[model samples]
Target: MDYIQPFNRILLVGCNECVTVCSAGGRKEVGLLSSALQSAFLSAGKSIDIKEHTLERQCDPEYVEELVGMMDGVDAVVSMACGCGVQEVARRYKNKPVFPAVNTKFMGASERQGVWAERCQGCGNCLLGITGGICPIARCSKQLMNGPCGGSTNGKCEISKEVDCAWQLIWDRLKMLGQEERYLDIIPAKDWRTAGGGGPRKIVREDLAG
Candidate 1:
């Protein structure tokens, strides 16, 4: 990459968490990236020593500390995990330059064999109970909580025909559950302060601490 300037040796670290399940930065992906980097460096008339290792979960400090044994002669690190994994690695090893190889997409679920779709936005307030289990905040393009937007036509969103109208799904599910009356109730506006809008979020559980 343009960022890995003049690299003689680099460590390719992979995460076996969400990235592994998504087939982005698992063990197999780490090997493939290592080979690709080796080929690129060789083609440029400069051989590179690539050390590949896949951590169980790079987001955890216990797993990130495993990189201590692999740091020798490593000019830089190429993290094939999500943004969280990359940041953890950078935080643990502040002296080394960590570069990301994969773009962190979203907090999503696997739709099918190889497809993943966004499911939750981690909003502090959850209204799935009233919305009939569908998250309008994430599924709806407009994030409307009251009712279906004027752009909804034939159960599909105006943004795209392929995208379903979240409100319509909620309505249909509520009707099936014999709770359509709940749809008539007005939902309060969201207080984004509890969400990331306030700042970087952190949870401290005094009960769990020793």
Candidate 2:
């Protein structure tokens, strides 16, 4: 709200991808935000024109190009998708201002109804095979690869009692699979370059491009 000043006419673009499944930036959320913003402007003695639309996937250029015609009446756009979606929209329409309405939290899973938990960090490495399917990079508070940190207590992490000790779960899973010997293996330090540490990353396949 504080960042949206100087723009009375705006468009709210929602994504029908991950955000839609998570109920964050779907068609339903777009409608709610549009109504709320309109009400807010009216209450402040100002009128706002809000247009709402949900793309199949905002991260794709084909979907983002749909907004070109809709941009005729709106001064700015409020994207309800994740950061990637917002960037794609901005890239498609360079002259218009774009803003994000939802904070992109993390790559997580729906633990239960109305509840989600982080699952993957996209760390550019897959240690799940050795770790017995538990990702220490995402679940461990310290992202420990070898074993549990000193802060792990009673099969729980020091960050919170609710948070399980990732290493403990890994060990248990390995034991169940009769592969506890793998636990003795020392994993080397991660090369963060593959994990997007070397600035923005890209993949180009000449065979697929043409």
- Best of the candidates, TM-score: 2
- Writing each residue's lDDT as its tens digit, candidate 2 over 94-165 gives 888999999999999999989999999987878898899999999998988899989989999999999999
Once fitted onto the true fold, the runs of candidate 2 whose alpha carbons sit more than 4 angstroms away are none
The 10-residue segment of model 2 with minimum total lDDT is 1-10
Relative to the true structure, candidate 1 reaches a TM of: 0.96
Candidate 2 differs from the real structure by a C-alpha RMSD in angstroms, to one decimal, of 1.1
Clashing pairs in 2: none
Q: What's the residue-level lDDT of 192 in candidate 1?
A: 87
What is model 1's C-alpha RMSD? 1.2
**Model number with the top lDDT:** 2
TM-score of each: 0.96, 0.96
